[model samples]
Structure formats: structure tokens, C-alpha cells
Target: MALWSGRFTASANEFTQRFGASLPVDKRMYKQDIAGSKAHATMLSEQGIISHDDAEKICTGLDDIEREITKGTFPFDINDEDIHMSIEKQLIARIGEAGARLHTGRSRNDQVICDTRLYLKSRISNVMRANYQFSRVLEKLAHEKQHVIIPGYTHMQHAQPVYLAHHLLAYVWMLSRDFKRLHHSYEAADCNPLGAAALAGTTYPLDRQRTTDLLGFSAVCENSLDAVSDRDFVLDTLYACSVSAMHLSRLAEELIMWSTQEFGFIELSDTFSTGSSIMPQKKNPDFAELVRGKTGRTVGNLVSLLVTMKALPLAYNKDLQEDKQGVFDSLDTIYDCLTCMAGMISSMTIHEDAMERQAYTGHLAATDVADYLVKKGMAFRDAHRIVGHLVLLCEQRGCALTDLSLADFKAQSSLFEENVMHELDIPSIVRARNSRGGTGDKALAYQFNVVKDVLHQQEELLNALTRSVS
Candidate 1:
């Protein structure tokens, strides 16, 4: 007989029982469910709602059930409907009447949310750790490749010369924002919702604050109905995962382009690359492509939850059961993708010669040429036009701007001088822009220091959160 079948005259149809069961989707939260039950039992004993002896029996039975499940000896019945019912049914079977007292002041509505908050808190910590690890790899790669010059692009065309370190740090900053978003999600999931039984406060002398502390929650959810019904924490987690996956996809796309024969900027390690069966010459970035492709699924998971919660009326609904699978899937996806990305980045061989060869091919110093004229007393707009004509002149003459004579340059602007040749030098072009955030040597050094400081702070925050939970 089902736990809630006390008033039913007949059994539920087998198909309905199987279809309604969340055992498959939520069984992964067994640890969370058991942890919540233990806390609830302890709180109940403390509040005098259940005798201390019964509470001990309940806690002991729950501990045994957790061990059995962990050891693969627990019997999981689909008819039990969810992890809560599965464990509770086992608990009652083992401890008899004492186990029945475990549910005296709680409802599955609040109970489920409690378990979810506990589970998501740990998950958020894991993702934050992964983000920090990946960001560290990026910082290391940047410092190692700091002196390697590459062409910076706008609209898919070469625009300026920049150090490879500068390029990699852009993603580091994007990931730092992603870290903040995930942290916000963690905060959203840090509240306790255990006493909001069936969307109303129980009449029993239940102490929500006791459970809050027992479970390491930051606060008790203030309103009963909102506590039972709220899924914003799950949505926040999904949104963070979506944005992080998007950032990974962007990085993956760049890896794909860089590994291509035409770009030749980097060579993916053989362990991370795959070769075609028939085409022996093809070494493809299959993992990078897979991470890029999986971004759609993570984004879709966020949208799925948003649509599920769009118009549902207050306190709890069957529709809300659709929440866990997508969130679980998205969290797993992004963490795995982060691990793969960090590995690929850490192992890839940067081809500095190839990058330098391509860096100067598209008249990449044209802007520096214009700036050179700007410093000489020519109006900035006039310098821009003169450089444009000079680029045209080089194209017609089948040579580069650097190959042009001083006389060749003076024809366009009297500002042209011998120093113009030095201005066209690629490293000089990169170094001249010494503004605080520019891609100059000093600027990159400052940015590296900032990245280190931000990383140190993030590590401290993550350690503090870990200690709180511990």
C-alpha cells in the first residue's frame, strides 16, 4: 500500500504509478534526502515533538538506509514514487512506529525543497571550484605565452597586433563574471525551507531555526507558501550554467579556428584530438567541437525551466517535478565541459612562428601608421584617409606598407619620416599603446597582477564556503 493511500478505496493504476514516479529522476538526490531526514529528526527531538528515543531510532534507521543504498544493497521500488517515499518506506519497515513519527511535523512539499537546497549548495561549490581551476589554467597559459604576438581582429579582419596573453585573459575575465553569477546562484540556494509543511506553518512546536543550523542553511525561508513553491534557486543555477556553457562554447570555437590548417595558431594535443578513419591526414578537434555543440542543450535546459514556471499558480504543482532532470543535466554538462576545456588549453602547443607570420600579413600596422601621423601635427581624420590611400597604394604595388620607401609614404602625407618605419615594426606597434588596459607590455603585467589578486580572493571565498558546509 502507498504511504498516502489511507483514504483511497482502490489502488492507483499501475501505469499511473509508474508514470508519476520520480524515483528515476530524483534518486540521485538520495544523500540529500537522508541528510534532511536526519536533521529533521534531530530538530523534532529537540523541540519535544517526538520522543528522544524515537528520534534516535529514526536517525539510526536512516543511517543504515543510507549505508545500504551506498553499498548497492538497498531495494529501490519504483512504486515508492520518489527518493523521499523510498527511504521513508524503508525506514518505517525497519523501525516500525518510531519511523512513522519522523514525518509528524513535515510535509513532502517542504521536505523536497529542503533536499534540493542541500543538494544544490554542494553542486554550486563544485562548479565554483571548477571555474577557479579553469581560470587558473588560463592565467598560467597567458603568462607562458605573454610575448607571443598575434593579429587582433574586428569583423573577422585583422585590426591590430596583440600579445597572445592579452587574448587569453579576455576569457579569464568572462569566466570571473561567470563565477560571480554562480556564486549568486549559491546564495539563492542557501536558505532552509523545512518547516513550511504543505505550504503552511505547522501547529506543532517546530523550531525551523534549529533545522536551519543543523543543515548549514544561512536562513529560514520567511514565507511558508513561497518557501514551498519557490524554484528561483534552480532557475538561477540553470542560468549560471547556461552563461558558463556559452563562454566555453566561445572559447571552443576559437580553439577550432586556431587548430585549422589555415589559421595554424595552435595545435591541439593528440590525446585531445581525433583522426578521421579514412582521412589519415585529418587531426580534428572533436572534443572542442563537442563542447561547442553541447552549449545548446545547457541553454535549452534553462529555457525549459523558465517555460515550466511561467504561469503556474502559487504553492506547488505537478509541473514543478519537471525541474530536477534539466538542472541536474545542465550542471553535469558544464562541469564536464570545464574539465575538458582546461585539459585542452593546458596541453595545446602554441605555434608562435605561425602566429607571427600571419600577424603581419594583413598590413596589421596600418593603425600605428595613422597614429604616427597623428603625433606629427597632421589632423587625425586626414591621417586616417592618408593611411587608407597608402594601404591602397601598397596593394596596387604588390608590396606591404613596411616595404614602401619614405618617399613613397611622403607622397601621401608630409608627416612621413624615417621614424615611420620603426612605427610599422610589429612589436613596436603592440608596445606603443601603454594605456592602463591596452595590450602593451606594462599593461599586461598590471593585468596579470590583477588576475592573480582576483584569483586569490576567489580561492578564499570558496574555502570559506567549504568550511561553512563542513
Candidate 2:
């Protein structure tokens, strides 16, 4: 019999029972559902809404159910509708009337959301942990390759010279923001919403604060209507997942490009790579490409929920059941993507010689050449024009700026001097950028220190969140 069979003459058809169920998706939240029930039952007893004996029976039944689930002995039924129903129906069968009293002051509307919030708190903690670990991998990579100079690009054209650490550090800062966003999502999920029965307060003297404390929630959701209606916690996490996935996608794209024979900047580890069946010499960065490709699914999950929530007149609609599957998928997807990304980066080989060779081919020192002429008392525009002409002359002669002699430089502009040769040296150009946040030694050293400090903070946060999960 259905829980609400008193209101209906008979149960819905088997097709309706199976089609309307959320058990397949929400069964994974069994632990959270059991925890919520135990806490709610305790609160009900403390508030005198249920007898102490009944509360004990309910708590004992839920504990036994949790163990059954952990040991794969629990029978999950498609007609149960969701995890809340499956647990409740089983509890009623085991403890008789005591289990029926468990729902004295709450409804499945509020019950399911409470379970979801509890579940998200734990999952987001793990997501943030993986995020922190991956950030550490990138920081280690940057420190190892600190001195490797490569050409920085704008519009995919080399515009200046920079340290490889500078490039890797860019992704670190992006992930740092991702960590903060995930923390915000955790905070959003940390609120308690258990006592708001259905769309309004129950007649029973429900002690919401007691349940909040029992469940370890930081705050009790104050508005009864909003408590059952809100899905913002899920949306916040989905948004964070989308943003983090996008960051990983950007890194994946660069990895794919760098692994190509044309760039030769990096070689993915054999463990993280695969080869074609017919092509004997190919080692493809398939994992990186998959990370890039999976970003669309994460983004689509966010959009899927947004559309589900956009026009709903809420206080708990049937449409809200659409929330869990996508959020669960995104959570799983992001964690796997982060793990794969860390594995690829930690094991991949860096080809410094290739990076340096490509750096020399792009006339990467042209800006410094322009700055060189400017320093010699020529107007900046006139210096830029002179450097442009010098680049043209080098092109015509089929030579680099260093191959042009003082006589050849003087032919283009009288400002040419022997010191210009020193300016054209690749290392000098990189070292000359000593301004704050520039690619020079002093600036990068300072940046590395800041990165270390940021990483320390991230580690502390991950530890705190992990402790909270336990």
C-alpha cells in the first residue's frame, strides 16, 4: 500500500509507480536519509512530540537500516518513490507503530531536502579536497619548471617571453577561486531545513534548533515555505562544478595542444595516454581530451537544473525531483576530472629544449627591441617604427635580429649600438621585466612566495572541511 493510500481508493498502476520513482537516483543518499531520521526522531522525543520509547524504536530501526544498506542487504524498491519513502516504509514494517510516529512533525517534502543538504555538505567537502590536492600538483610542477622560459601568447601569436611557472601559476589562481566558490556552496548547504513540514510549520511543538544541533547544521532554515521550496544549495554546487570544469577544460585544451608534435611542449605519461590501433607511433592525450569534452556535461547539468527551477511556483514541486541526478553526475564528473588532471600533470614529461627552441623562432624579443630604441632618447612611436623596419630587414635577409650586425642596424636607424646585441639576448629580455607581477626573476620569486602562502591557506581549509565531514 502507498503511504497516502487513505486519500486514494487504490494504488497507482505499476507503470506510474516505476515511472514516478526517484529511488534509482536517490538510493545513494541512504546514509544521509538515515542520519536525518535519527536526528529528527531525537528532536521529536526531546520536544515531547513523541514518546521516548517510540523515538528509541525509530532511531534503532534507522540504525539497523543504515547497516543493512552498508552491507548491501537493504531491499530498495522502485515503487518507494524516493529514499525517504524506502526508508520510512521499511521502518514502519520493522518497528510497527513507533516507525509511523517518526513522521509526526515532518513531511517528505522537508525530509528529502534535509537529506540532500546533509549529503551535499559531505560531497562538497570531498570536491574541495580534490581541488586542493590538484592545486598542490600544479604548484609543485611550477616550482620544478621555474626557470624554463617560453613565449607568452596573445591571439595565439607570441607576444613576449615568460617563465613556464608563470603560465602554470595562472591555472593555480583560477582554481583558488574555484575553491572559494565550492566553500560557498558548502556554506549554502550547511543550513538545516528539517522542521518545516511540507510548506508550513507543523502543529507539533517541533524544536528545529534541537534538530539542527543534532544534525550538526550551522543554521536552521527560517522560512517554512522557502525551506521546502529552495534548491539553491544544489544549484550553487552545480555552478561551482561548471566553473571548475571550465578551468580544467582550459588546461586540457592546452595540454592537448602542447602534446602535439608541432608544439612538443609536453608528453603525457603512458599511464594517462593511449595509442591508436593502426598507428604504431602515436601516444595520444586522450584523458586530457576527455576532461575537455566532459566539461560540456557539467555545464549542461547546470543548465538542466536552471531550466527546471526557472518557472516553478515552488514550495516543493514534483519538478524538483529533477534536481538530484544532474547534481550527482556533476559532482562525480568534477572529482574524476580533477583526479585525471593531477595524474596527467604529475607524470607528464616537460620538453624544455623544445619550448626554448620555439621561443627563439617567434622573434619574441621585438618588444624589448622597441623598448631598447625608446631608451636611447627616440620618441616611443618612432622607436616602434624603427624596430618594425628592423624586423622587416631581418625577414628580407632571412636572419634573426641577433644575426643583424651593428652596420645593418645602423642602416635602419642611427640609434643602433653594440649594446643592442645584449638587449636581443633571450635571457636578458626575460630578466629585464623586473616590474611587479612581470616575468622577471624578482617578480616571479615574489609570485612564488605568494603562491605558497595561498596553498597553505587552501590546505588549512581542506583540513577544516574534512574534519567537519567526519
* Candidate of highest lDDT: 1
Q: Model 1 — TM-score against the truth? A: 0.99
Native-structure RMSD, model 1: 0.9
Query: Ten-residue segment with the worst summed lDDT in candidate 2?
Result: 461-470
Candidate 2's residue-wise lDDT over 1-470, tens digit each? 88878988889899999889999999999999998899989988888888999999999999999999999999987678888888999999999999999888899999999989998899888888899899899999999998899889999998888899889999999999999999999999999989899998888888899889888898999999999999998999999999999999999999999999889999999999999999999888899999999999999999999999999995889999999999999999999999999999999999999998878876788888888888888888988888889889888989888888899888878888889888888988888787988888899899889988988998888787776667
Most accurate candidate by TM-score? 1
Model 2, TM vs. native? 0.98
| Candidate 1 local lDDT, 230-257, one digit each (tens) | 9999999999999999999999999999
